[model samples]
Target: MVISVKLLEGKKVAQALDETMAKRVESLKEKGITPGLAVVLVGDNSASAVYVRNKQRRAEKLGINFQLIRFEESVTEQELLAKIDELNNDSAIDGFLVQLPLPDHIDEDKVNEAISPNKDVDGFTPISVGNLWIGTPMTKPATASGILMMLDHYNVDLDGKNVVIIGRSNIVGKPTAALMLERNATVTITHSHTKNLKEITSKADVLVVAIGRAKFITQDYVKDQAIVIDVGMDRDENGKLCGDVDFDDVKDKTSMITPVPGGVGPMTITALVDQVIELAEGRING
Candidate 1:
């Protein structure tokens, strides 16, 4: 007897999410509320450009008003903070986020603090994170929220499951742990210096890897029939795009797994639009 493994494609999951939100987006427009999202880019980083472009494209498709505010590398921290204040006060904008990896001169934490919690669709602000921990989150961090949406769509029950997340970055791991805990899953987060990494990972019912390594989590690290979510975007030795998990090596061993390019990538941007729509709706109701 053979157990057939399943692939959880993120592109399809993202599409389904967008489809569900399409009518809601149009409904906002029907009521004279056009959801708006703005992305502020401090410098021209290649990776940040790719993310911004993806968000812009998806926002247009979903009928959300999107804007990219580009600033030179020399832009001062004061200038960036002031701009965030402006956007926060701008009634047209429902939500906004400053693209990460801003110039070294700018204090990233301070910038996040400057964005109004109501408009922080990226959910990086202290207020947003605090809300999440208190069990009454307003807008979730997009990537983490997107991952949860994917898991929920696939009917992956989180109750009482052991979830081990291998990246502790604020954008992915920490928030994701909070979400799993919300679902009654026991969560453990491992970072760069984690000892006996494989031993811990092998016990997880669900594994999510986002450590920015290429093919780092192989068959040895994953438990049999575990659900794997790969949040990495990396290039293999042959210049082929791959995930942190070696999909070919680990796919057969897992009950379900998400691929790199078509997996978690698509859902990130879709979640952004969903947050903007929610913010816009709230504004209208208030």
Candidate 2:
């Protein structure tokens, strides 16, 4: 039985979403508003740089007023918090995010909490997370939201499906579980310490992997005809980009799967900019 596999190409989905979002930006402009978004980057993390670049390009292409604030690695915690306060009150900027993995001297949670819940476009704040679980999200974490958006674009109904997410991070795993639950799917979240991981995964109708381990999940862990969404952005042994699930090793057995570079990566930025646009829309509604 040679099962045909469908690739959940997030790049294509992002392009399709961009068309509608761009029009929304244009409409806001006609009403004397241009959606504004900003990112604050500290130090020089290569991966963070790439993520920020992708976001800037997309936001600008949609006619959003994009801002990038750079801070030195030696900057004090108080200074960073002060900047956050400024952006929180900035009327022109609808939403903004501080790039994560900040230097050891800075407290990440403290910074995230400082961003106003309304402008917490990355949805990392406690207020945002609480709201999400309660079914009234102010904004969603970009990567998790993107995953659902891609699934919806493909018309993969989550209702009554068993979703096994192989990560428990606040960013992806927890939020994904919350969103899937709202759609009436039964969700299970597993992490590095999960015992009998394969046993749990092999029973899922849908599997989402975001453990940051290159090619960690293979066909052995997947159920026949299951849908897989890989969120890993790790380098393989040969220094090539690859996902948590080994595409070649698992694709033949799965009904649908996402590729390493063209999958969840692009959709993340699409979801980020979409959140910014929504906040901008609110400005007009009030």
Candidate 3:
């Protein structure tokens, strides 16, 4: 029996979200409210720059206001906090985020904490994360929300299923497990230290891989027809982009899977944009 696989493309899911956002933007504009998103990018991280550019492009295309606040690598932490404070009070600003991986001198936690939870569209603040974990979500972490969108888009049912997630990062892995559990699936989180990782992963009815290593979960780690979602954006030996799952090796073994460039990546930014709209509408239910 030859079972065909479904590739869950983020581009398509993002397009669907784009249409929804466009309508919402138009409605808000009629009421004299233009949703705005401010992104604070510190230093010169190439990956962060690319991500910011992608976000600005998408925002502009949707007619949403996008502000890119650039800071030098040598900028002081106090300086960033001051700027965040200003944006917090700015009435026009609906949502904002400080891009991660600040330089060694700055405290990432301090910056995240400084941003008003009311304007914390990144959903990294203690208040936001806490709200999400307990099920009454005010705002969700973008990547995790995006993963849920993928599951919904592909019609993958999670109820009563064993969902295994790799890499327990705050932004992706942990929040995703929480979201899956909200959907009634039993979730297990594994990291670098887990014993017999494959033994654990192979038991999953749905597998999500966000471990930083490129192409880490090959065919052996997955069960037959299990839906796979790759949350990694990594480079291969040839300097080409890849994901946490080895798409070439594992695609045929799954019922559905998300690819590297077009998988969870696009949905993440889209989810961020959605938060802005939700904030403007006074409907921030995560």
The candidate that wins on lDDT is 2
- Pitting candidate 2 against candidate 3, the one with the higher TM-score is 2
Better of 1 and 2 by lDDT: 2
Global lDDT of each candidate:
0.91, 0.95, 0.89
- Alpha-carbon error at 281 in model 3, in Å? 1.3
* Residue-level lDDT tens digits of model 2 in 122-234: 99999999999999999999999999999999999999999999999998999999999999999999998999999999999999998999999999999999999999999
For candidate 1, the per-residue lDDT at 166 reads 95
Model 1 stretches astray by more than 4 angstroms:
none
User: What lDDT does candidate 2 reach at residue 172?
Assistant: 93
Question: lDDT rank, highest first?
Answer: 2, 1, 3
lDDT of 1 by residue, 1-286 (tens): 7879888888998888888788898988889999999999978899899889989989989889998899999999999988999999999999999999988898999999999998999998999999998888988988889888888889999999999999999999999998899999999999999988999999999999999999999999999999999999999999999999999999999999998889888888877888999999997778
The TM-score that candidate 2 achieves is 0.97
Query: How well does model 3 score by local distance difference test?
Result: 0.89
Cα lDDT over the full model 1: 0.91
